[model samples]
Target chain A: MSVSELSLDRDPSSRFVPWIVAALSLMCAIALGTAFALASMTADWGRAASDQVTLRVATGDTDIPALVDQVARLEAVSRIEHLPREQVARMLQPWLGDVAQVDTALLPLPALIDVRLKPGADTSELRALIADRSEITLDSADAWLAPLQDLAGLARLVAWVLAAVAVGAIMLVTVFATRSALVNQRQTVDLLRLIGAADGYIAKRFQRHGLRLALFGGIAGTVPGLIVIFFATAAARLQGAALLNGLTPSLAGWLAIAALPLIVALVATFTARVTVLKLLRASW
Target chain B: MQQQGTDGTGEPLVAMRNVGLRYGTGPEVLRDLDLELAEGSFHFLTGRSGAGKSSLLSLLHLSRRPSRGLMRVFGHDMQDMPAREVPVLRRRIGVVFQDFRLLDHLSAQENVALPLKVANSMDSDRIDEIVQELIEWVGLSQQAQARPPTLSGGEKQRVAIARAVISSPRLLLADEPTGNVDQEMGERLMRLFVKLNSLGTTIVIATHDLSLPGRYGYPLLHLEDGRLSNESGGAA
Candidate 1:
């Protein structure tokens, strides 16, 4: 037999808990999704660059063959692939569209060679060797990769900050909602008190109600966000992995969305529990 | 004035000594009172409109503590008891207010089942059965499903009375329970209290209707100037 003498009809339209939790849930989904995507992209970039270096030789330089020979003999060098001039030009197509009108020999284009290093090999000796050649320039992809990776890391940080703010907002809204509920049910509270109801009993009732509202609202808000992310990822992939393609979360991000309702519900429940306990103590 | 008047047993149900109550900085509403109620005792706590009858009942209901002196219920010092233990102490007593104080949202049956719910009765089926029976006993069976706002004054009073005694509380206190009902309905409600008292429930009713107590031969406890003028003999 529950002591729930209160009718939720106190103000039926005043139930803004679901909308509040839902909006927070949507924001949480976006943050988590973006963070997870950026993190995975950063990991992929690091793995590809960790054991490799690239070298650029001026296109018309006849010393390229000797440079390649010397580079291959280095203890750190495993194998090197010399890029055809056309391939290098194609790589620069986005910035210099259709440069074929210029004569290939007179073009300022450079021939690129990709170097794969043996595990645990020293690239310092190779760098010293390449420094002696005026026509050969050695560059590790990580030079720019590091900053790109850092940008991804920074994005992940921003997502985490967003998540923290969402959780804070959840607590704030739950506190106000719990307060409103307490005021609305003031008569019920007094009646229960006069009838010898334990404080835990009263608190439990409000906590349960608040948790339900948060769960419903949170799930309602999160599902649409997940769908939007999924469709956006699909649309981008259909366009052939265009720039800014990795906007979808990895498996873990989806899992977080799956569990978001419970997490937010717990937040609401715990907040209500604490708020009710404090108010009841003050009444005493 | 620690007059110990136990009924059959050695310990009185309630014992008070020079108890006085003041709200914040206000003047005392009850003061300098020494009293004891034996188990199963019945008293009509009566006075004029502003003579502190309800204030005395506030103490009895554990609504507030005395600013000075001692107040004990069921042999436990109220001031010395932990705040958390107030609910446990309150479960032993029941109160009916002048306004009835029935929850407007809950149905009459729900209102009546409140004390039983507070007592944490395990058998839901039995609780339902008893609540229905009590509603019938109060002659509101037809109105059992009705909300407080929809019921007549007499019907609301009946529900309040049922709620107060549903737990079979050791102490039952009513403040002007019959204030809203007509003469016949008031008499009928008084008989209900009398019947509960006969069933070994200690009853105290604060009312201006003095005839019912004399008719039932229960003592009248009169209040004046925030002090009790104990009238032990019935009908005095």
Candidate 2:
């Protein structure tokens, strides 16, 4: 066949495959992006709360004056609130049952001072400072909370790994889908070759098809991803905790979600192009 | 044999000297074959089934390279030409396969318009006009809008033929083109080939039909077990 005649045999339906690939790729991007956003928010919350060390200080009547003097010498203390024995008892009344008269003889009721640490103070340095104030017993607020913060960090790391795995899976699926399309059109390719169609022409058709498929898949995938992210944020708020506080994606996040389709389309296009070229080189 | 017009140049349009073809170190399907097709000549190649007729046409169509010997097309040595330049040479040749090879998805008109579209030589309006004319000429006017699956065997053959000659190729190659058609249709199709040949196109048809060459009075090239013999009283 003449070059002019060979030019005419293109398939119109080839466009759809690339569009689908593009859509799928976009969805994968949104899934990955949302995961990162959530993880960052959780990390930030832990970091903010971990920066400060709060102490609860108690002193009996004999050491009251000395305890006050010792508390004044601690450099880590940012603000101290002094509470009398009656106030401490009143605060504990909700947890204590039927102890109004019985506890007066056995319980050693003492005055209390609540100490907040300065932002830059090291937890160990604050502990050492409190240890020097022997007349008052000081307990670090983070002694029990430290393990919880560590767990949150570990969870964030796992979320990141999960996101990476999802992206890899998306790529693998896209490659397989593109390969299927190429195989389906194998006869068309042979016909084109027989008619003297250039390799670039054949590759372009497949690339365009892949880009379209990725775009459609990506867009479709984003809707469910965003829904998942929304429910997650809502659940976190309902639980009286801020999961993605400072890292909450704004309008930009929504825009990125919208752009997922286009990004996937580009990836599909390039991937299909390379795959088709390789196949043609190997076969032709 | 009648002597036709001489170009004063002896070079044939297609010249293959001692050409041998094999698939991956296997025995050659065609071995040490010498052949030539002069400009504007009409020839019929006849052989039993599996006699390498298709293979030889494939080589002529530039789809495959000979494993040994020298081949040339349109005055360019096939061995010396770069791989990229093969397409340029193939553009001058048109082929009609035994199975019709029409794209199932396209309408008859679109299938016929394929060659012109690939070459990008004709505008859309011109392509449509030419395709319509060819469809009518092949007596497939009613089936022009029909897809290959919907068309009959004869209709598909017409579409394939229309596509092959749509660009007015310099050389036309047909492989059992009328194998599926009735006797009347086959004769009509042969008339079309003759008309195209008279208009200065070189035509080579490979067929199993024995009486076709006797009826048309064209030169016959017989092939049996990969060997070529000229039964007609002339140098081939």
Candidate 3:
């Protein structure tokens, strides 16, 4: 066996290295996936929310043609469309089943109008003008949109927090594993020192070994995580929830994910090197 | 106060003035020791158990710093040298351990080649050539491919000796080089040290063998109760 492999073969911690790396990768994938999903969902919600308003008018005695004509001529109104009554009834069908049998007049749900706005237009003026009628109400969706946007932003922050924790965990794994290897190979390291092997030589050997273990572990851990994300995305698609569009990484994103193992490996290598140099100095 | 005695001008290989050593919080083991060995000299360090022979050798090997002293090895002042320069200093010396700390994972030839690898002196093929010749010289050519776990005590002892001298270090220190071997093998290993000494390499072998200085006709440095006594060469 090569000199580098000798230390690893004798070390007890070698067996668990891959597992530690894999666990970290799995956790990272989930976090990144959730973060990606949240961002995409927010963007979609924001796009659908902008430049629009939903209106519910009681239409008790007002002429339908007159209301439509007045709304179409409003200064800020770009386009107006009537929300079909059947579609609105279908939405409430789960709670009020079979709208055909339900009393249409007694329920008296106000007629809904879909309003498109000119860019940068103020809706408050129009709302004030319509509110005087006592039969009209304006719903701009900004109320729920602001809260959902905040929720998405919160998810992104959580994802970032998770990523930071993963990095810390990776560093911890390498430090502990390197320490264990050092302890088990005490005789070997001492012999190297006596032979006048420089600290770098000895440290390099262990660093390379730890880096390899972490790389393999990272891959073992990461691949499954990515696979889980892919399956989850597919499941979401099958369930007709496009909100998972965020979870599906783009080409550049996949490349970054592919590099996770290498990042962990590098962390392992650096940690091992520093640990050896310090320990060697301490011994002398 | 550290001072450089300097190198490359026929300076002594080692010079210690009032060198004192003790492990952490322990009583002094070697106290007020003053000694020097001229370049290219051979000596045996003979002392009783717990007489600080190993500790003194440890100081010489650069494995331990004298707790208090002005010490220089290869003319480089111990305290004046930077920590980064320690390994560079150590490369000039060879040490054989009493435990025969050969890596069990490596074969006999690989163990011997280890010093050359560390020194980065020659290419792999050249190292292989030099290590092969030494393995043969040590009379272990037949077991050159054998790992430490499979080798007998004598075989391991020879391998350790070969590894120590592989780099042709200016000074060779053996902490009980023959501690684990039989009489014949012990004598044989001593002969190897003698052979290296004759080639102008400074040699110091730490052993309890009081008869060794007399038989080898080399100078003796005797340590008793942490005190060192220098004796003249030739069976004194």
Candidate 4:
């Protein structure tokens, strides 16, 4: 058909449906990608926290004066805070809630030490340094956070698999839709064949149609997905200091989400083109 | 008849020799038919309902290949031609289906514009002008935007005819073009076909409408069962 006639027949607005699908696919991709990022970040945080806690416990026997001197000697040690028994007890009171029985006896609470490390401080070297200080004992710091971090990693892996499955589902839907359109327009196709239309031309029309639908659908699916992600991120940020660390999406993460709709569109286009070509070859 | 090969000049629009066809090894629908249609020669094909009128037209339109013989169009042998080449040849042949096979999604004008669009040969102005003229010719101008589902039988038939001839093809095949129309509309459609023929478009009308051949004084090839009858006569 003439280009103008083709344009007249095509509804440009019809593209919204595939765009929606692409958008949804994008959202899924973002979710998957965010889960991956969170998993990595949490894992790193858990390891650091655990090592710090271990160092604090190992140094527990060091006299206050000796510990202060040791802390002053280490270049990696940026800042240190020594908490007395009363402060430790106060901190535990929220969970312990009116511990009158423990108050009568001396609470066997270890002195709390907060240490900040310099940027790029090697955790292994620092752990070794604290280990040599026999007067000090450092128990594991964020040992409790390991399970949460591991769970995040597992969730990330599952999200990746779900994204892959979503892509497969999109391809199947495009193929099914193209086939139905071909069936409905069977007579028209036959007529076109009779009049000397090339299979490429016939397939092009369908590909264009399919691509548009997929793009719209992807957009539809992605917008709500992104919205959900946005809300989750915002909620995490709102927790402020209470959160272990605020989750921040990087530029690459956002870009990956944005690129998803285009990917869905491409997949739909190719699937439709291949399906139409196969059907034409078989029938005509 | 001597089977003409490519003579370096423009090829004969259609040539078939000992052409036979059947449905999946069943009895042949068309048996050993030898025919040549020079460019722009108009003829009428008359036969009983099951005598393979549609099958012959299908072959002419490249919808099916002959099972037992050679067929060539515009100098290209169809037997070994790649499947991709079929549509290029189809663009030059216009076919009016017996069933008025208009697309339900498209309006009358869009349906008629389909041929020109398929060929990718016209600009908007030319397409619009030609489509408008044809629609006017078929008296469907008032229903230009109406889709096939809403159109009357006669209206649908006219839309099909308009589509078939819209490309101004080198050959036009109309199978029972007037089958669904009243006598008045049939005559009008025939006049349109005659006008197209006079303009150097080869036309083949496949019909049981004996009155058409008699009225137009065109040569008639009559078929019975799967064979052509030897007797040649004109209606009084």
True contacts kept of each: 0.63, 0.27, 0.63, 0.67
**Lowest lDDT 10-residue stretch of candidate 1 chain A:** A5-14
Report, to 2 decimal places, the DockQ of model 2: 0.22
Q: Which regions of candidate 4 are displaced past 4 Å?
A: A1-37, A40-54, A57-113, A128-147, A196-270, B1-10, B24-27, B104-107, B135-159, B182-188, B210-236
**What is the fnat of model 1 with respect to the true interface contacts?**
0.63
B79-184 in candidate 3: lDDT tens per residue?
A: 7777667887888898888888888878899999998888776799999999889999999999999999999988888898898888888899998887888888
TM-score of candidate 4 relative to the true fold? 0.75
Clashes of each: 0, 41, 1, 62
Tens digits of lDDT, candidate 2, B159-225: 8889888878788999998899999889888999999999988898999998999999888777777
Please give the interface root mean square deviation for model 1, in Å. 1.9
| Best-performing candidate as measured by TM-score | 1
What CA RMSD would candidate 4 show?
5.6
Selected candidate, larger lDDT, 2 vs 3: 3
For candidate 3, give the lDDT: 0.80
Per-residue C-alpha lDDT of model 3 across residues A1-284, encoded as one tens digit per residue: 25552458557787887787789878987777767656666766665667788778885876656676778788988989887777777678899988888876566667888888887786865776687787777888789779768977988899979977987898888888888888888878877777788888888898888888888988988788778867886677677654444446556556677788888889889988998888888867
Q: Give the runs in model 2 whose Cα sits over 4 Å from its true position.
A: A1-34, A46-161, A181-184, A242-247, A250-254, B1-11, B75-88, B149-153, B230-236
TM-score of each: 0.85, 0.72, 0.84, 0.75
How well is each residue in A26-110 modelled by candidate 2, as lDDT tens digits? 4455455555565556556556555543345443444555655665567755666666556777666766754564464456565
| lDDT, candidate 1, at A74 | 88
**Ten-residue region with minimum lDDT total, candidate 1 chain B:** B227-236
lDDT of each: 0.81, 0.70, 0.80, 0.73
